[model samples]
Target: MNDKNDLERLRIQIRGAVQGVGFRPFVYRLATNLGMVGWIKNSAEGVWIEIEGTRSQLDLFLLKLEQEKPVHSLIQQLQASSLVPLDESDFEIYPSVSGEKTTIVLPDLATCSDCIRELFDPNNPRYRYPFINCTHCGPRFSIINALPYDRPNTSMNAFQMCDRCRTEYENPLDRRFHAQPIACPECGPRLEWWDHHGKRLASDEAALQAAIQAIQNGQIIAVKGLGGFHFMVDARNSDAISTLRQRKHRPDKPCAVMYPSLAAVQKDCELSDLEAQLLTASEAPIVLLRRKANISVLERVAPNNAYLGVLLPYTPLHHLLLSALNFPIVATSGNLSNEPICIDEREAIQRLSGIADAFLVHNRPIVRAVDDSIVRVIADREMILRRSRGYAPLPIALSKPVPTCLAVGGHLKNTIALTIDSNLFVSQHIGDLENQATLKAFKQAIDTFEQLYEVHPDLIACDDHPDYLSTQYAQHRSSKFPSSQIFPVQHHHAHIAACMAENGLEETVLGVAWDGTGYGLDGTIWGGEFFLANLTDFQRVGHFKPFRLPGGEKAIREPRRAAIAVLYELWGEAAFDRTDLTPVQAFNAQERDILQAMLQKELNTPWTSSAGRLFDAISALLNLVQISTFEGQAAMALEFALEHISTDEFYPSVIHQGIFDWSTMVEEIIADIEQKTSGAMVSAKFHNTMVEVILQFARQWKQKRVVLSGGCFQNRYFSDRTIARLQAEGFQPYWHRHIPPNDGGIAVGQAIIAASQLLKRGG
Candidate 1:
């Protein structure tokens, strides 16, 4: 006790994902074990600690702190200096300090192994508890109201801890120590089951049983989960799936299934090492897997989709609900078509009443609506299809620090991003801002992020598309802030930039952008594009030849119209009578005449080089999809057509003057169909042709790093094939893994691109 001469005190501040992840408890255990007196606490900036210890002990403490930090805690910065000691007698954790929060908020984690074991353990107090969670797992961002993350500011605030749980929370050696969302059945939220008419059916165990019974009875139930509600039904029930699809007005969009166990998932789908790892990872994202031929899963759940989107039960409630049933449930987002996920209990019951037969309700309020994150293995690596719930709020690190900025994202798959210095915090998947409710949610997200991260935008970025709600949001932002700058980024450019930003690559690279549509600089619609790009600039090096859409937006929904345009371009008047051109057979004489006139006069017709439109046209010509019920339905069908096919043949095309001439390919494809070519061979060759086109650009640009992005890349066949071909040609092809390759990931690119431009202007 009298070793004062050798003793020292230090005030250390740590930043980065250091909150809601047991960081303070980690420090407490380490300090107490080392016989050091200290007080640790969470703050807006990060963790702050005051330690008094001998020189050698302090040195050992620092070493272990770096080497043995909490598994989920990522220490971005740690600053230490000698300071006056508080003369503390024992290590302790003080209440979190609130003000300007900079420490990262943790994403909601999937059930940890220990928690999973305790869930099923008969001897455990929390056995079979629907809300069981601990420090290592359970909800975080989805439940957080604000940060300096603490129970008082989360959805868990209403659930006061019982004595035993409180003791565990206060004990540094216990795993639940300082866990914000810690709860057990005794002092936690309970469940309720309600009929569509708002009559309560049952409670607790009975409620769960009723929910499962409803599903087994071929009824769709809106079940509350971690982030929001999910529409649940027996995956094997074709009638229920069709009924739900009809009620939801989502005729062909694939529904995600939640299996009870890993064994069940493996039995239904072809699993690979990477896919299996991703499915079971802490995020517990829905992974697209090749479905087994003999599985009882109804095709109605995912018609024409080559891969089934599947996820394991990630939460205690999910585990319990799945445990009560023998079959997997279709756990799709609780929203109509393109609406933001439903979070409020009453709102869910009201809005989803038409689609869901019953509601599996809960008392705990969700702070935000988060759709389940989605991923797929492409070229043996993970590619995020949708980012939300279990993989959000945690910022993506930039190559260097930049000023505060906000990006409002695209009109479809909207996700807003905010940057404070080097950390780029992209919000959870905000649904397409087409409806008032979704737009309100998007606005709320902007406000919430501004308050949470405590940063005002120096600039805002969005798409150049004038009609996009995101563009309007940015315009309004500039007007409201007055001093804020606004950057209107091209759509395809943003798609490519997102992948590049996530990879932290600043150098110029070859970017291949293909999706439904983007506003081209020359007053035409663009989608198939190749660019030589860096953060600050991009040069359009190559693109698909523009073709007119017979009825503009109408052509997007009706693939037959796009096919008519392609055929009209190819054969003029002769295309209408071609007996092999079967898409024409689906149209009436009047409709055909009107479509032909629309194409000839180019009235209400817009030209686009979109690879997506091309896919739609090809699918229509083959009579696979004459009219689409969903945005990518035709393209999805085309990808599905590749199943059980092996071919090296491809329709030939040429590139001249930076424009890819697909006329030869289109003409040949028509001729092949007339010659009775199989759809599988045509689909395989179509995919192969895309690979060849990308390879041509890769070779011509001479950039080793090729970035493949845009919604078109969401097709597994196209993305995987293109990536494999590029890699084999000795090019390092960068594809999206965290942010979606679709519009959901576009905001990140918009943010970084604007940041780079701002830095250049020294703003």
Candidate 2:
């Protein structure tokens, strides 16, 4: 008995990552089912909806829209207003309108359950289709070329849709209505196999079968995935694993092991509830888990590491390939030690031919190289070690909104961050920018994020260090965009601020940032630092005592140098006579005299209060590692040394005049070495000492909350124990979650601090 005049009309505007993720189709279905009349279309700004119906029906539609949004669509803001109702007849999806873009770009997602089922179903049209996807999952950042996300604006435009797919695309009733990446085996990219000689072996199903057989027969296969090529080998084959290690020149670094199912992962490693959930999450990432002692996985895969990095297949090709295999596979990035992962087929074959026996590639292009994200579960929380693949390009919701800004990250593990309105997007891991390839990748990441968001940045933030390439890049951009304000944040402070930003901490907290090196305000190198900080500023209240970084940056690769410095400070010239010293034994008399003079006169040696260097020094003293081949090899070796043992005892440490000293710890380690202390025992004691000394410092600070960040915290053995001890002391401690603890996360901190400054200045 409702009057026609009583019928309500409303116009709704929704923001966030609403496009290319089935938002419009969902709206169409809900409105049509509610017997309402409306026209829904995508705009660059967001989703716009006009609906006419009875008040009750209109009310139900709004509630359901909020409660049951599309799986991958994140609703940031929703607004509704009354509208004049004409005699609108039916619900329809209108053509996309290109307008000013202000919403979040949809991030790349793992395949959904429904789409996965469809991919494997023999009766389905997309059966065994390698590029199988729907609105709920698949490429977003990598494939997209522009906003108002449609197939024409994506790489999918290369393939014309067939009649059946066209019908689904045009019909609002279909599940894949307007699904941007929708494709079939006939209309989409096909898999092909090629030998190292560049001869084509097979195609389609035969190619996949060939790939399976190649991996089964202890051969390496470079398989192209959503982001890049994964050089895969049978994990159970120790010879295959060793061969891959030798070819890749990655001797001890752990590689990700891909299993077809949770059962397969469980067969080799113990999975906690959180770990299992993370492994099977929609944005599935590689999870680092403790290996079962008696597991049959090749020992060479992880070597001395206590944990194995494991992942379940996240793409259609992976699903199809693993379906034909029964063994876990070692899936490492297809590249040499320092280069970016291979994205192009030709590039992969050219670069990975020495490592890969055959190549399983596709015609579809990967617009960007996104590495698989790495994660570990600690203290019932998900800690992201490396953010990429499934979890990146998604905006981090800030505690307070700020103006559009960009933060160029630290030098070592560079990544860029852009904040448009309230959404903060941190780019994928853009490897060290010293090399031309990585620098190009860095530029591409920044440009890609800029183009994806259409953000005209109003502010810029970068590291304080003048020598860092990232800082220089920011300076160059600042000069290019003269109107944008530029701010430089201290490096270690940026680390702590990043921890604060991710944890939503607006109040002052005790931040203990431990890393390798950062340019301090006093023109010295600071890495092990304790600060009282909020978003705006920080005070250095406590820190590790300074030690000479002999030969400057060269000491980073030679932990023996750092050890020599510490030993010299402890026992003078007698430090060289220590019988257990490996570096002293190797050094000729002249070389030893020169090194001693350099330390004494401080020639080319800079001082560093770095916890990372301390770990390096300890590592060398223990004879675990003297010279590092990679950036973190020595420190990582130190972490792994005590992986098999548990200890509560700690070496002695002293704090005087707010300067924490590890001289006592160094001396005791030397004594332990002279007494032939076990490597595991010394390593355990060192880790425990660091944990104890930091807790003592936290007690001195008297802050109820503590924050830990920087590259040093990436060590699970260190972070886990530090977090545990802090919790025991009735103190709340915060660490990185969705972002890494290392320099990769510093951009978020820089951006946040800059934004806070802008807000404070009312900019």
**Root-mean-square deviation of each candidate, in angstroms?**
1.8, 2.1
Residue 28 of model 1 has an lDDT of 89
Write down the lDDT that model 1 would get: 0.87
TM-scores for every predicted model: 0.97, 0.96
- TM-score of model number 2: 0.96
Error of 1 at 164 (Å): 2.6
Collision pairs in model 1: 44-101, 44-102
For candidate 2, write residues 138-251 as lDDT tens digits: 887777788888889888889899888888888887877888888887787888999986688899989999998898889999999888899999988989998998999988
Q: What overall lDDT goes with each candidate model? A: 0.87, 0.86
Name the runs in model 2 displaced over 4 angstroms.
582-591
Worst 10 residues of 2 by lDDT: 578-587
Clashes of 1: 2
